[model samples]
Target chain A: MRTHHVTCDDDVKLLAALASNRDAGFEPLVGAYQRRVYGLALRLSASPQDAEEIAQDTFVRAYRALAGYGNDQIRALALRAWLYRIALNVFHNRVRVRRVPTSPLELDDGDGPAFRIEDGDPRTRPEQTLIASETERELAALIAALPPHLRVALVLRHVEGLGYAEIATLLDAPVGTVKAHVHRGAKLLRASLEAHNREEAKVEALL
Target chain B: MTTTNRTPRTPRTPRAPATPPDASLAEVRALLGRLRALADVDAPAALLSAVLGELGLDAADRYFSLRTPVGQIFVAFNDRGLSAVMRGESAADFERAAHALLGRAVHPATEPPARLVAALERSLRGEGKPVLRFDLRGLSEFEQAVLLKALEIPRGEVRPYAWIAREIGRPRAVRAVGTALAHNPIPIFIPCHRVVLSDGTLGRYSMGGDQIKRAILAAEGAAPDVLEELARAGIRYYGSDTTHIFCFPTCGHAHRISAAHIQHFASEAEARAAGYRPCNVCRPALGA
Candidate 1:
């Protein structure tokens, strides 16, 4: 369901193909969006097995739904956003049913010394290098720690490069709420990374 | 400035200025850029097959090509029935078309299942009734009707498209009947090629064009050369001078007559005017 920039011409072509030939047209649709959907599921579920099942379920559901859609509806559909919405719904339902606890983002109080890191001064900013030095696994773990709603909004905005309005439409929330969620999510991520960097530096100094 | 207390407090360091919003956002963007690598996760190739299986489609359908007398013909079928038969097409083309129609990729087998092999042989030899099942799931009602009627045209005999239309009670829908036959998915089983033009000429065919149509008809004991010769000579119906019966040139009973005893007529009126009755076997007057 992550939004990508599919062209209007492509949408028309795909819709036409689907309308006339569901089986042939569906292959290209799956080829186009499978990876992105799988990636979103993986990031959301944080389990490869669950991601695979979720991705498979998303396409099957989409195929069934599109089979009943009229030509005009298919032609006018925003495929990327529509798919993301379905995937997000599937992911959330699975989470609820399984009662799986997503990693939580924990923010220390501002009284922590890491909060004193200056914004404007370039000399005090080692957060970028610290993040760069971390492994991809660690970075994914950090992203996984965000709250579900914020993580979705943040990932859609940053990783997927979707606009606030598009994310709002997908999430069925107000644009203002989406913007606030993304902003707060980013703030928390930066603070958590900064605190981790400070702790690492302390350990290094002790050594 | 407030007056200093007795004991000078340790110089309080000014709190570091808050990180610039733009800088923090840039940091988040950088982190997200790293996460973008996860997008390359390839869903297993079997995922599509899995989905097709879940939908009860033909993902597990078996297919094989047999080199018959006419040409190389590809056939695909599932437990439900034989779904498709295409002539002179490559395996890839057959697979693609099958997938498009059935919503699943069919696997090509080195040898067809025993039952299918037997059915194909019987159908090719134009022998006894072959017991192969047909998967006509997506065909329109008219197409199914036309094809089902076409199946009644016995192995060695051919019927005109008009005959099919009239048989279906849509006598005026001859063109529509042709279109429906042309769209027939399972060709040999449906036998669309057996339907010809009203003038006893081999009409347009959906399989491998008219030539293959002629070949299949010939293999079924219909004389393609005789039909072509009669069409070329502007003969619509052939009348027997001795038997006093008019029959299609492609008819087996008519084919046995010598050219000396045969009287050719372009119109049914001309044949009837000459005191010839329609042959009960060929039924040429049905379309004439």
Candidate 2:
């Protein structure tokens, strides 16, 4: 059951625009996917600053690549998968060079909410809002702490709502391998959550 | 049978099957929903211009004459952000000047974006954090750093070019910082006017002149007259004798220091040696 997707409905229109002129079309293309690309980069690398650089470089590479492509080739591109592939590659190369990845997940103080915040309902209690935000932040930190391969696979599968075959294409891996990674990722995440809940249970008992 | 095509082939030899977490479709959906929410994030506003800045796309695509406290100035922008702010003789003159500066054609826009108009208006009032992004195409890294640091100067207070240099981690580039500020295309919004000379005097402004700079500063609530008097007296900082704190003469607290307890320092070391500490509000040491 695919649960999500990072898709653009105007990929065809955007491609037609780019096919005519890269300059005029690139801004709209960027506008459509900038947040999605930044989200993918942030997931792969747990730092927002790194995510921004990676997203910027990804578009630069994407722009140059599109410039060299034929108009037909440009129109045929699977926009979401193609852009995420570039962003993922950029994130990897950066990690290879920089080596040590320091993310806010390592320090609770440095990270604020990475999730979107809706204006709170007046009926909701302040403490409930606080608890929900805290939970979301903790859940995000747990996702960030996953191993790179599992993290990438799980994010693509669930966050992007992508099929295993589409993810396999993006990862350049076998469909079985991609599915295995997703399965392992989910199992590990569930176990970690259970462990965390038990620890909280002990703290609550003490209190 | 219908679901068989969607499932992947078994890649390895089957071992004892372990209980899979969230095997139920509904539970899996719930788990994935949490992942999606947690993974979603927003891009920063500066990212659009940052891309253009990286691509070196001098995007001075359109212009509109903005009515500002400093008078009418042509503001050029693209989808990224405000690219340039310049004063010229006329519409044709503005087009020619902006074109020469950007090395690109500048078209006249009928109305700037409402958000941009609002940002410009708020900037004139010397408000808090800036709301608009500057495209900053064709500027060197050193120059961009100088301009951005200048933006941090509170509207009414003044810092010397040396303060900008040190703030950007280029302590010896005071003269170069001056050059950068002078070349700043987005002047008033970036607030290059708030930076004065180390001797407490207003300096040359590339957009207009020193007179305009003083006028803008005075409008923002800085006592340009008092700053000039301090420069004439060779007093760069003022100290409260009772409070034992020293601050730049332009500091808001400096204006409140009663005359009887007022002491002055020509240099930071002089104040430090006189048993006075740098004011937390002005941060004399940081600026000096």
Q: Give the candidate number with the greatest lDDT.
A: 2
Q: Report, in order, each candidate's fnat.
A: 0.30, 0.39
Runs off by more than 4 Å, candidate 1: A1-5, A19-28, A67-71, A102-134, A191-207, B1-29, B35-42, B57-60, B64-75, B78-122, B125-219, B222-253, B256-260, B263-288
Worst 10 residues of 2 chain A by lDDT: A107-116
How much of the true contact map at the interface does candidate 1 reproduce, as a fraction?
0.30
DockQ of candidate 2, scored on C-alphas against the true complex (2 decimals)? 0.16
Model 2 interface CAPRI class: incorrect
Q: Which stretches of candidate 2 lie over 4 Å from their true place?
A: A1-9, A103-131, B1-17, B20-29, B58-288
Query: Cα lDDT for residue A47, model 1?
Result: 54
Candidate 2 per-residue lDDT over residues B1-288, each given as its tens digit:
000012435553142125454355665566667877855556777677678667765364888887777688888888778888887648899888888888877898877778878888887875657788888868999998998888877778998888888778898899999999999988888889989888988889878888888888899888899889989999988999999999887788887999999998899889999999988866668544
* Superposed Cα deviation of residue B14, candidate 1 (Å): 24
Could you tell me the lDDT of residue A187 within candidate 1?
62
**Candidate 1 residues B1-288, lDDT tens each?**
111111124332232123463464555446666656545445666666677667665336789988888778888887778888887668998899888977667888767788778877888787776676787767888888998888878777777888788778888999999899888888877788888898778988877788889888888887788777877888888788999998876677877879899988898889999999988876767644
Work out candidate 1's RMSD over C-alphas: 12.2
Give the total clashing residue pairs for model 1: 2
